[model samples]
Target: MTVKTFKQGVFLPHYKKYSEDQPITTIDLPNEVVIPLHQHIGAPCQALVRAGDRVKTGQKIGESAAFVSAAIHASVDGTVTAVEPRPYFTGTNVESVVIEVDPEQKEPVWPEQDLSSLDKDAIKAAIKEAGIVGMGGAAFPTHVKLSASKPIDAVIINACECEPFLTCDHRLLIEATAALVEGARLIRKVVDAPRVYFGVETNKADGIAALKQAIKDDETMEVVMLDVKYPQGSEKQLIKAVMDREVPPGKLPLDVGAIVQNVSTAIAIYEACRYKKPLYERVLTLSGDAAARPGNIRVRVGTPIGHIIEQCGGFKGASGEEARLNKLVGKIIMGGPMTGWAQSRLDIPIVKGTSGILIFSPAMVAKTEHRACVRCGRCVEHCPMFLYPSHIGMYAENGRYDSAVEWGAMDCFECGICVYVCPSNRPIVKFVRETKRHVAAARAAKAK
Candidate 1:
């Protein structure tokens, strides 16, 4: 049987060998953690703890009045050090609660319940209290996803970690297969879905096998192997790959009678529903050419990037700005190379959505300047949404955001495919992002 995939996607280096087989390692508890209040897609959370206050692990320290937002919890039992604006992975400073860990640590314990007896509202309340969000970089509130108004018929577990140099999902599937399947079932129950599908890429053979063995006895669940291609893990693409459903433009997965959740996110749901564990920590990949040791590690939310690198053995080769040649040209990405944000500082705290921390040396960094598009149409050919990226990019660059909007800039997900394949080194994704921001501002102004 042929594996299913969405059209117009690209194939790139998997870059998984460095840490694919490395079992998940736990980072030593840091003295301080900077928990950002706005980790999810919706409204920012309000701090519940002030300086000098004490907090416990898994305690809710931040919450919002908004229904779309997820709560924030403490990862360590510590005293509140401060609550201030701090740098986050998205290149912006967010209001964060800083905690100084106590000298003596106490093992964090949560409520353990019989999941079979819980109703849908109870499960959703547990998940919302746990601060569960999409761990695959979207950071959308999982409780909101579970409470969709539309009737769902199928749920797709996006196990296709197609991004290069990232294997946290693969490692999780191998290590926590039972939990993931249980989490998927929990989601099915919440949405009242009849069928569940694990859409895994062909490259993740071990993950697929492990999940199959775990769910083989379940009649409603099926494991579907997807094409080993880029963007195959995207929600729309995964829905198409597994269920042959195409979500119409300007719509959502709920519109097509389907819902998708990340593999790690599913594990989180299981942990939350069964053990009443809040999402205070998550598994992430730390790798790249500059990394001294490449591996997957479970880390506390709000831990500094610099601390994580030190525990992983720091950078490869030399140290300091003088010895590091890439200091001028290289970048440290907060996620996969294709869609990750380039970071200028190492002090930012990790969030629930952070999947990988990839480092690039000067040699590995792409060297290119802004140049005119050759109009080879490579961007259009590789675009999963089939939009004219060149036109949007040019219009955005020329400050003609209206034209860019007309060219369907808002439809672009900034997958970085056009930028990756551009011969002229055009920062197409960046331009599209700027245009979208402008369009959004215009819409907001008009609405007022």
Candidate 2:
């Protein structure tokens, strides 16, 4: 039982006691759902159904002919009210399919298929057709990983769930252990990989035990226990921790002869291949200091955050006098606190990459004005990628985008460790994001 980990990652509080042990509950369908045209990293999908068109559950409503893009499906049987711009979690408006949920809805039945006879192409086709993506929040299309040009020897299933307060992956491991392992194997077959590794953190002892027992008889599968560290589940860091491989900058895990997939992503792959089911719904954690009820829930893809929050009992102190004035909740984040977006409004709907909805009380949130960098050098010491975040932030702060890139600003994964450890409370991740946006815009202009 050797413990493995990469270097230079911060050790933060787990904060998972609230919902780590809770079983995933299926949430009731909302009155309306908003499915964004682009939920993944690649090209956006075009709407296949217009306003007033009726769509059934699991129906493909949006798709792109691009090889890197994943299709978008309807999560419920309903009529499309609009195919237009709507608010997203990222604080930007995106073209989305708005559907009014049918009152008398029937569950879509997916007849299970015999998975034994499916070949590599068939399995990949199933994954693409199901519109599965990296469910750990990246939302990178899974089929693109399977179509790797480089030879892959090891497939690392990231079960770390290292983000504080998000326990959806931990609950999945403990509850759906067999399905996760089978899904990992299916991914391996698609890539022609020889072995599979489940990289799990030590904090989730129950999940580790469940996975170990499930893979006991399989020689090709093994569970690697990782140290409890922030960003341990990140692709490059996970590869380094599990197989001692380093993915070079500007490259992918496949470059180092490995493929990394999140625990929930693997489970989605299994569901798609075995049951011919699409990824219309997913499990996510709803927890934080301001949440009235903290638990893991299986919700449809297009459900609005406002509806989900109300269904879960609303924010804490909801019935109190302060709640009436909306003074109880200070912040509502769409994912893990460290790396998630700070949502301004609750109307934003959950997409495929959503992993959690965190609500924080005003007392829990630190309202401080960011000051100048004090040059303490804590961000560099704690950054998992070992980049000079202070220098990058300083350069980007002064609109020096070239200098920021020279300092490896593009390599930073926006893990938020810099912001967490900075004494000045500088928003280094935000600065890095601004630098990236400027850089991308410049590149696009140059191309023109």
User: Clashing residue pairs in candidate 1, if any?
Assistant: none
Local distance difference test, each candidate: 0.91, 0.92
**Estimated TM-score per prediction?**
0.97, 0.98
Model 1 C-alpha lDDT per residue in residues 1-448, reported as the tens digit of each score: 5698999889999889989999999978888999999999899999999999999999999999999999999999999999999998877789999999887879887668899998899999989999999999999999998889999999999999989999999999999999999999999999999999999999888998898899888899999999989899988888888889998778999999999999999999999999999999999999998888999999999998878987887788655354345473277899899999998777888999999998878889977677899999999999988899999999999999999989989888888999888899889999988997888798899999
Clash count, candidate 1: 0
List ranges where model 2 is wrong by over 4 Å.
319-326
Best by TM-score: 2
Off by over 4 Å in 1: 320-329, 446-448
Candidate 2's displacement at residue 32, Å, is 0.5
Residue 82 C-alpha lDDT in model 1: 95
Q: Compared with the true structure, what per-residue lDDT tens digits does model 2 show for residues 1-448?
A: 7999999989998889889988999878998999999999899999999999999999999999999999999999999999999998888889999999998888888888888899999999999999999998889999998899889999999999889999999999999998999899899998889999999999999998999899899999999999999899999999998888888889988889999999899999999999989999999999999889999999999999888888898888784335637788888899999999998777889988999999888988889999999999999899998899999999999999999999999999989999999999999999999999999999999999
